[model samples]
Target: MPLMLPFAVEELEVFGKCTSGMWVYARNSTGSRSGDKIVKRDIDLCDEHGRVCVRLKGLSFREAEADRNPNPGATFPETLESFMLEPVWKPQAVHTEGESLGYARHLVILCGMTGFSSRDTAKRPGGMQFVQLELSQPDIAERFHACADQVFEMIRDLLTEKPQERVLLQVVVPSQGDQQLFAGLTGLLQSAELEHARLIGQTIILDTDIKFEELVAILEENKISREKRIRYQKGQRFGLSWNELDAKEGDVPVPWKDEGVYLISGGTGGLGFIFAHDILRQTKRSTLVLVGRSALSPDKRTRIQELSDAGAKVVYKQVDVAMEDATHALIGEILRDYGKLDGILHSAGVIKDNYLVNKTTEEMQEVLAPKVRGLVNLDEATKELPLDFFILFSSLASTAGSAGQADYAMANAFMDAYATYRNSLIKTLYRHGHTLSIHWPYWKEGGMKVDAETEKMTLQKYGITAMQASTGISALYRGLASGKSEVLVMEGELTRIRQHLLSEAMEQVIPPTAVSEIKESSSTLVETELDTGNLTDKVLIALKLEVSKLLKIQSGAIDVDLEFNQYGFDSIT
Candidate 1:
């Protein structure tokens, strides 16, 4: 006797008219197709242009020995209604607009209960259960907005229809490692404001070593399982152990040769200039390519001349790196002139500080273009080049969220992920290039624009004493020498910043000693009082006490007029 399985379509509705051309439909059967005994049925409606107008997918399972008697009273709709209510399988309808449509190439309609167990529950418990929708062509601004809105409406409907289980919806756009797609997805998510369900916007990088299973795992661990609203890459080791290797200077080896050519994006900026000077000093005979969007001023020209006089060949190109063609042209010109590309210091970025609610799409793109898109352009342009180092300048704001820098934080977070992804590719290809993303805090001098009030608040609330330009440059050089993929440079009492941080990952990375010392120091400051003596005596006593506290020693150990260098005090301090 043969096994008999019954199935039916419960709901049918046409979304919109279909356009002409070839169409592709993909179904992620992680949860739907499983086990041996089963029944499968697929229904697709095609138009005159050979386009898939509508599609319905169904799957079911039954025991071989179960009653095979067909019920005459069972209607198709009634059977489908019961089947849709069953937890075993759910049906989803997808409408493909075909290649000719100016809107989204594919629009997926998710019906049935929202909540379901993840495909890989053993690897990631409580992970997100989702269906991936792929978008091929780029939609116009208005169309993109409409498409995103439509998707959000469907998600809202699912949430309303099934309130018991958590619904996870993901929009997977094929980016091919382009940052523009990521930026577009981010803008859409920000604009849509879908707060009901767990919404994820991801880019699918093709022709890479990233396996499908690994990608799924990354999505689950980083975005779904974690409580954070935004995530770029998953399974990254956040906090590295602060060891003597990080502090010891000469022990860390510089990888670049003196004759190699070095490039710095945003090389006209304050931090960029400092890094340029430092790199010149490190490799005096190296050729330097300083690319920036602004024309070189007379003062900057003199500075470039000074670097030239100091035995470094300096070249400046006023070009926007965000433009892919322009960046590729610049790299081609550099390779033609220098004969080899050695290293890159990507410090190009812009800032548009605003609350998340007030931030506009243009503002976000302005900040992201130079940082995220610029990095992508450089990576794509230099895939075949033998580069020793590709260092990206990120920010501490990426890991520790900032109140008024949502766009900046997201941009830097992309850099963090890009570095990791690029490094993985490099390893797979057996390449000799190193990629590192340095997350830096504010510098006392030559940092971002901050008002006096904001600076004071930063110091008081976050205990982030700004790092000096010299100290920060030294740390950067040390990081490059260490060959670490990611390094975070921050200077301050770790305890104060730790208290302000709400991230569990960050809390785990902080050393216990740093926390205890801050607690002890706070108590000491409370206990110690100003001396009630003459004005001169009070001043002297207060100065001694401050020095003692700064040095982490008792007040009795301080001596006035002593050489500050003996106590590790530099001119900037």
Candidate 2:
């Protein structure tokens, strides 16, 4: 089966009438259809008059092989569940107390808040209600995260009033769920909300464009279940799901280069050093450049010495990826020293898990800077330094949603999209090397997991047995060879794993995007001619409100004429 993932679709610049119909043409932007490919072109729907009536811009298609279908047989038949339901949990602490809580790397509940009332029952007859949130509007793409901030805040406040009550948050996302990175913000937010909801109370999300009667049926169903629910807005999709590396692929020699200089961000600890050991031992002649924000600890120095004793060169750069200047300078220095960079392994990330109510904007950024902003910086610095491959170490949380990890989920989600974006650039710009993002499952070690009990609980809850170092290392090599933009390693059988994931109550046919109905998505929204090219006042107002909601600030503060950078645009990534 053919598969398509639309990165962005704005039917902008529609003018001529298509009543008589128009020709729909898809040109393979990539000259050759070999291995992994990305198709970027303007699909103009023109009428008999040869006038462009409808235009679709920036939608990309990637192939697993021969313009390959990454997950050949995985996609939903009836597309775009514009309206669906999702479940969430509230936070235990106040909305403004994150910096104080010093949240643990893993799940942690907020406490010490007053004025919240507890009650029985997650929902009642009248309690089965919802609020509309349209996060799919194209114009807000630049400020999507800012917009997400507002939605999450609203969720925080709504649930804050009555922590023990169950409320449904009706969410509107583009047909492309997680693949459409901007719209995926809602997925991350819902996941984060659910994360918090699991800790506090109940706040669910629903994305629908169905008839009101159908919605009523869903509501009645909600009333009956008394259990939390979240409709999979996007259809059946499988591109982001990673496959376990069979012994053959894992046994294939790793992507090692003799005398190659490899850069590993977030390379100081956990998987970083583990890879360093592999590279030094396997790629004995290569120079491993490790990047981390922390100073070298004595224990780390000893490990480096051991690797050095093995033969390869090991160097560490204490720099924060969030700081572009420092990051760029480090890359620059590396290029100067090594003449040419062979590969990049971006595994740098930070975790600050807290419920939405307790997490402040600063806290959110704190978690995002390393993965989101930092990746942008890395891209800017390395865009000129073409090499073999650019590997991003992503997480399953972005796919499954993590409580108290909206920022983290949002960041990784961005990475998932960025990998595809970078690959498109590679094809169009004639850049060397491919970009692959491996959305990994929980590792048996170094995921900041200290206790064995927590690991066991993870298995019990998600049916995800922690991955061993050897297995993950082999999977990493297999992902590098896969050629696809993103490979989310799916461990075990889907049938059994689905059982555990359903325990999280998030196993709907999460809509599979372009393969679904874009028409249905646009037709359902009544007062919003969102898909049109001519940007209207209502559209602008809606966008302003979107950002305003995210910032929890006044819409008036956003000047339409001002450059987005003037308002601190770097954080938007």
Candidate 3:
């Protein structure tokens, strides 16, 4: 192990095999300042073509003059005060096992839960089912890795060997703040998908201190389709809930200080920059510190000026947040120059999408560096600061699961856990700091640039629409004001997403998809021929053609209206 410092021994990633004749460039970008305890250096080893083979995160610190003691208070294990803020879920009410939740009658089966898996429950085949697989809290406490293996075996056996059913996996954990462990398990639950069964991932955090009957009561309550996450503390139950913001409402302020200093990782460009724009608009004249791995380009510089034009001071920092010391040095500099730091919006992360069979451990860690380690570095840097908020930009993929995103999904799961961990120490670690992890869906403008066809297919499959930029910003404002540890801001049919995380149940019961129907309708029109099957098909064609001409897009661009509500009407109606 390397000599201990304020920051130490983060992971290193190798992109390609190193070759001979690689030149190394080293430099210090900033002038030395008096009273500075840390120095940063940037070193890059590049090939003859200037391709970077390896880079070093410049972190140099002086020895402490005297013995340093950071925390004088009681340790975490000695008290339960920090764990008081950990998120919990409550039951709607305990109901009969295998009960219906309006969509259809679901076949309910319990597995791995002691004294409950043996129950003879009736099965109902209404195109969907719910299976609750439990992990004992004591088992998790005693042998975690063994329990982890059990978690795999249970889900694997259920999906592969048992009758096809929609899964609502229920995992129970101890009341302690083992956030990393919790989030890691969540990553496992999120990936519990199969070709036959639609799985709605569910987690229950039942305190070890709670009685067994208390656990039984909560399990009965969770059988209803509406019941998902639930937690019990001292025999009292709490439920996991979600919230959305109306775009028209802006009076609920974005959390900001009056001309206060704020930092955003990944803020030099993309969603980070857009977040800066929204933050400044909501809280004018604030000092914005934008940090990213890359330096500002001409376009980014112009955008920074635009932020300045909006009556805000924007400072851009080039730093690898995955590097612990590099991140700490940057945060220390920000606090020293600005006098007081207010908030942080950690939007930094990378995605390495590959099939689990094809992915290497190195690739997994590379993807996790920006999200898991990056957020941890941010927290360590600002743990003692009197900050107001620290917002993490997480993804629905963590909660809902995304194929070929094992590392990405797991990394995001850590973000969810970090939010819980940080909030637990609100009274101890921070003066006024609160943490939030916004489990976000894809945004229309600032999100990944998907083609319209791909975008349309994804939206239709998920029973959701790509959130507009205004809607996403509005959600940020609401998330900060809501005083919740984690929130998923989404627009769409909640139950549809609940049924299959979007058909990962669609395979079993989903009829003709909207995207497919839209394509068929387009081909029929191009051939200038009717489907000749039914009046409904012809009517849809005519409506789409007329709507397409009005919208100035191709007829194929018009999707089938899957969300036809009884209340839907226009002025013509």
The per-candidate count of clashes, in order, stands at 0, 38, 8
What C-alpha lDDT do the candidate models reach, one value each? Answer: 0.55, 0.57, 0.60
- Score residue 63 of candidate 2 by CA lDDT: 31
Tell me the tens digit of each residue's lDDT in model 2 across 1-573.
Answer: 333334434346767667635677655343424233455666778776676777776544443223122663632122211111111222211112112111111110111111112331122223333333334533323245555566657656654664453344433333233224443454455575565542222222334344344444443332222222233332221112223333354345478778989999998878998888878767658999999999999998888788878877888899998887898899889978888898989999988887766778778767777877787788778887768888988877766577778778777877877786678778777456788887777666664443444443343333445666776777777767767777666443344455544432321222212102222232333244365556676577566555544544334445444433333333222
Supply the TM-score for candidate 1.
0.52
TM-score of every model?
A: 0.52, 0.55, 0.55
Residue ranges of candidate 3 with Cα displaced over 4 Å = 1-88, 92-172, 178-181, 194-204, 209-250, 282-285, 295-302, 305-312, 428-431, 457-463, 491-573
Q: What clash pairs does model 3 have?
A: 41-58, 89-231, 89-238, 89-239, 90-238, 90-239, 129-166, 503-506
Question: Which digits, one per residue and each the tens of the lDDT, describe model 3 over residues 1-573?
Answer: 112132221234455667757887866536634345544455677888888887665434332221222663421122111000123443443433434332223333333333333332223223334344444545222233334445545555555454444455556655565423453455656655422235545566655455545555565566453333456666666654432333355478657656788899889746887788777876756899999887778998898998888778988889999888899999889978888888888988887776543455567667777876688778888888888898998887776566777567767776887787788788675535888888777667776556554444454544456666776776777777767777776654454444433233222121223223443454544345364657788778777665654443344444554322111222233
Residues 498-548 of candidate 1: C-alpha lDDT, one tens digit per residue: 444433334333343332343356444323444356777767766655665
* Candidates in descending TM-score order: 3, 2, 1
Candidate 1 error regions (>4 Å):
1-133, 137-226, 229-250, 494-573
Report residue 539 deviation for candidate 3 (angstroms): 20
